[model samples]
Target chain A: MQNKMIGYVMILAMLLFGGLSTVQAADGAKATNPEAAKVEKMIADADKARKKAASVEGEWRDVGKMLKKAKAALAKGDYKTAKKLAAKAKSQGEMGYKQAVAQKDLKMPSYLKY
Target chain B: MKHLLKKIAMLAVAGGIAASAQASPEADREAFQNFYKNRFASVPMEEYPNGVYSIDPVGRENWEAIEEFPPYEPFIDEGQAMWEKPFANGKTYKDCFADGPAIAGIYPLWDKKNGMVITLPLALNKCREANGEKPLKYKKGSINDILSYIAYESRGQKTNVIIPKDDPRALAAYEKGKKFYYTRRGQLNFSCANCHLQNAGMNIRADRLGPALGHTTHFPVYRSKWGTVGTLHRRVTGCNKQVRAKPFKAQGEQYRNLEYFLTYMSNGLELNGPGARK
Candidate 1:
């Protein structure tokens, strides 16, 4: 009876430890996936760029919408689509900021005689 | 050392004079009107209120025909009804505007107390809210109806926007508006000046870009594109989007300041609003 009781205790410990490891492994796979991590970083970089442009009142209309689509793509595991959208958004943000900065001084056009 | 210091002071003073000369509102307006005058020498200053029709003879024929049987007639009638109708509180728009309907020319004025630009549409909405009625939307719908009537009533009234000397903020608002006009924006990289000034007569595909000179004179325009009348701010919003830029809110600071600058530019031109447009 004592030996049987010890055997049952050993089985119970194995089942508990095995279930915990399975859950941890699943979580580890999601956390360590390089593609997902890369896309997340790209999205974050795009958002930062967009905010920088907005700080100068130079943000384009579609940058926010593009970032939103990128996040949705990332959620659906579409890393390639997500990356492309994020990169385009970042480029637009940079262009808008540069455009605004270039015209910091209100230069009257040559055609208008001032 | 004294000689070098003197040279530096002279250069600084010269630079300061140049900047202020360029910044003067009167100087800017003169330059703006001259550009249009030089471009279209035949069109009288009074005719600028007709917009592109003053320049585009071919289009003007069609426009004249349309004006004979104006599409905006119904809106004017509707607006009159709206004007006469009392609010739930037994108060009317007259209660707010003692000067009455023919007061379009005096608006887009700088409100010193608010430290901001107050436009006609904004004032009308304020009147509504004060009378316990819901404020009308700025860009579209019933607002256009009332504006059409007010604009028609205010016809022939000259555009005269006053920037008070007492308030430095008013001048700042005008300067900001001027900056907005000249500054390039959107994916297309076009400023308001690029289309309406630099290439005013140039064709962008099928459309001939209109001159900026009398832009503010005609408002609450009957756009065939919209199949109804719309406000100047509505047209401005459409222009921003056409350039692929995010449009600022209608009647917001950006647009109100823009109107203040634009109307100031059109000073002395007659108001022919509720005008028909393609």
Candidate 2:
């Protein structure tokens, strides 16, 4: 009976240690994914785009908001989510700038040509 | 060979004239004025300052009724008091600007020292700040009231904004304002000219889009929708918001420049501001 109880205690200890080690490994992967660097670069690129939009006074409110969210997600170690948000922000910023540049020569009806 | 050369010369001359016509504000103004005059043959030039009311008979009846006991009257009274009241240093608005009626028409002027446009409302705020008082807000309440009085005082004064060729900055500001007027913005993708120029006198839903001609003549308008008088910048902000565009600050450089351009377009039209509108 003594031997059996000792065996059971050792198994319990192993299970507890194994579970903790697995969680740590998962956390490590979450915090230090190989893709994190690529996402960081993408976020930087998106931020540059946002700045370009703002330089021409063409930034929309959503572009800024999305960039903020992207940075927040990045801070939380959610690289995938951060990359997605950053990409969206970048698209919006580029589009806003394009719209402003295109509008530099506005089109009006022939009657309103003056 | 001689005939071909002559044709080329004639073509070049025609192109030059066309380019100059587009480039000259005076030429553009003449064309703009003629467009309105020809379109609304029955309406007199003086009445253009009245805006949509000058064109829409039923709207005019309603507008006249509002004018009989104008809501802006109290604001003008308030403004008169503000203008006459002494500041912290015992200096009044008179010390800042020429004391007389119709002074508002001369505003949105280029300030050589500042290298920027100085609008009447901005000038009023500056006077306050100069006199050791806090400046009034640009779009509402006491500021609008004082502007109302000033506009009322300036009634019948023709807009006469000048862009002195001597100052490159002055022309730059005017050009910026003109670009803004024609530039499409907002999610709706419309320029100021889209509604005011092309669709003037036309109905968009229930409201008539007023002409760009004499648009600046009557400002600080008692818009029935707002149930209070609003400055031209306020109207601009409202228009921008309506189109889903974020507006520049009232009295800011963008707006000041826009006012300069718009007021220049209304040159020779009588100032009829603090007017009633629907």
lDDT of each: 0.87, 0.79
Clashing pairs in 2: B102-B153, B102-B154
Q: Compare the candidates by TM-score and give the number of the best one.
A: 1
What TM-score does model 2 score on chain A?
0.64
lDDT of 1 by residue, A60-101 (tens): 889999999987776555678989999999999898888888
- Taking chain A of candidate 1, what TM-score results? 0.72
Per-residue CA lDDT of model 1 for B31-140, tens digit only, reads 89999999989889988888888888889999999999999999999999999999999999999999878989998999999999999999999999998899999988
Report the Cα lDDT for candidate 2.
0.79
**Best of the candidates, lDDT:** 1
Candidate 2 residue-wise lDDT, B1-278, digit = tens: 99999999999977765564346667657767777887889888888898888888888888888888988999999989988998989888888886643588778899999999999888888888988999888887789888888898888778899998888999888878877887777667777888888778999999888888888988888888898988889999988877756677898888999999888888898998888887
lDDT measured at residue B91 in model 2 versus the true structure, 0 to 100 = 82
lDDT of 2 by residue, A1-114 (tens): 753654465456547786454334334444556675677678788888877876776665566678778766765457788889999988877876887977655342356444
Question: RMSD in Å for candidate 1, one decimal?
Answer: 8.5
- The fnat of each candidate, in order, is 0.64, 0.21
